[model samples]
Target: MDKDNDHGKNDGEQRLESGEGDTMRAEGRFIEPQEPRAEPGQSEEQAGTGDHATPERLDHPIIEEPHEKPEKRTTTELLYGVIANPVETLRYVAKHKLVAAGILIYVAVAWIGAFASIPGSLNSFEQIPEISGLPMFSPRSIIVFTIVGTPFFSLLWLVVYAGILHLIASLLKGKGEFPGLVSAVGFASFPMIISTPFSLLDYVMGIGISLYGLISLPFTIWTIVLTIIGVRENYNFSTARAVWTFFIPLIALFLLAILLVIGIIALFVGALSR
Candidate 1:
């Protein structure tokens, strides 16, 4: 009767141990066991069944798959892509820092526009009945000034505009660099290229500047929209944040102007009272 109790107690202990081992394995606290091995002078079944048996655990290695690279876009494709897939295209421009290409596109458009305006300017003079001779600011001189000034002013404006947007975006928790944002905003002006043909038509057909202005109005608005998109993508910001970043500088300037006017009016009132 004592022998039976002793055997029963051993069996209960073994069951408890097995249950713990199984729980550990299920919870991933222990690695899975390898093939069971027999002890010296012990049968495989006896070794596997006994408490002294502890099979080795095998550690599996983790393998990571490589990521695919983004496709490279040519300058032409990038310009077209702005219209087709603005988000991805602007992101690529910002990531790649295509500053030169963007600046070139803007400057080229400005130069073309300056030249196109020459025809209209000359035509306007011809329409006036009062003046037989060229005025002090002659058409030729104005043309020369326009052509020479377009490149420098356009390039400077691009840099300054990009800088303002970058600063505003940074204030809004943007993570983009100035050069990247320059490229982004530069590319954002891609939609303005659509007006080139209209300018060309105005130049060749002697259409009034009014026609060009009418045609460019919608495209100008579109360029502003693209600028907002570029800011959003470059800075990884939400649409509202990007819009705020774009407009904040403009709003500040406007408010400053108002304050200056008020100050001037107050000073004039003080002078009048004196």
Candidate 2:
């Protein structure tokens, strides 16, 4: 009996080693093998192999490209940009505070207009030799005067106009610098250049000056519109606010002139009564 018990125990051990015991445990049915599951925050490779991960088996790191900045506009671009696309160009001008470009534009327009009038000026003065012969009235003197005075007055107007706008803008809760406003205002005068060709033609061909004046009116309005746009861009103001900021100074000056005239008339009447 002991021999039979030992033989049975040995047979059971052999069956387990030969995989027969596993099949028997399935109860004559096939069981599918389940894949391993990855833990939370753990990659499949890491979960599958733990510390046995290899560099060649892992994914490559991602690299990002650097962003490029926009290029600056050229002089020719700026010259036509204000007329063609005032909003974007003026915004760029205000941001850069391009004082030199602004001054160049102002000086160029002023000089062109001044040069165009040279012939008309000379012709008008020719009838009066006494006036034309004066050193100041001579052609050379006129050229020199325009050369010197155009830049000076251009710069002066930029400063004065910008100062007035800056003050008004500040009063209206605007946040922009004097230099920026100056640049914007100088560029705003770009539309005035439109009249140069007509002025020259009128002077050279004996065309009526009234025709030039008529053509200039629209350009003047264009300049005023550009000025408003510049003010709006620089000050971060609404259209209504920018318009008000520009016209307020002019309105104040007009009212002041009217009061001065009224006071003068009142004094004149009192003196006459006496």
Write down the lDDT of every candidate, Cα atoms only.
Answer: 0.82, 0.85
Error of 2 at 248 (Å): 1.0
Encode model 1's per-residue lDDT on 1-274: one tens digit a residue.
Answer: 9999999768756855879657756787655557678878876655657653333421333456788887788999998898999888998998899989989988887787777667666667667756526563577677778878889999999988888888889888998888888888888887777776787666588777788889899999999998998898888899999999999999999999999999999999999999
Which segments of model 1 are wrong by more than 4 Å? 1-65, 125-136, 200-211, 260-274
- Which segments of model 2 are wrong by more than 4 Å? 1-65, 126-135, 138-140, 205-209
* Least accurate 10 contiguous residues by lDDT in model 1: 52-61
TM-score for candidate 2, residues paired by index? 0.72
- The C-alpha local distance difference test score for the whole of candidate 2 amounts to 0.85
TM-score of each: 0.68, 0.72
Instruction: Residues 15-62, candidate 2: write the lDDT tens digits.
Output: 778997788668864344566678888777777777545676667644
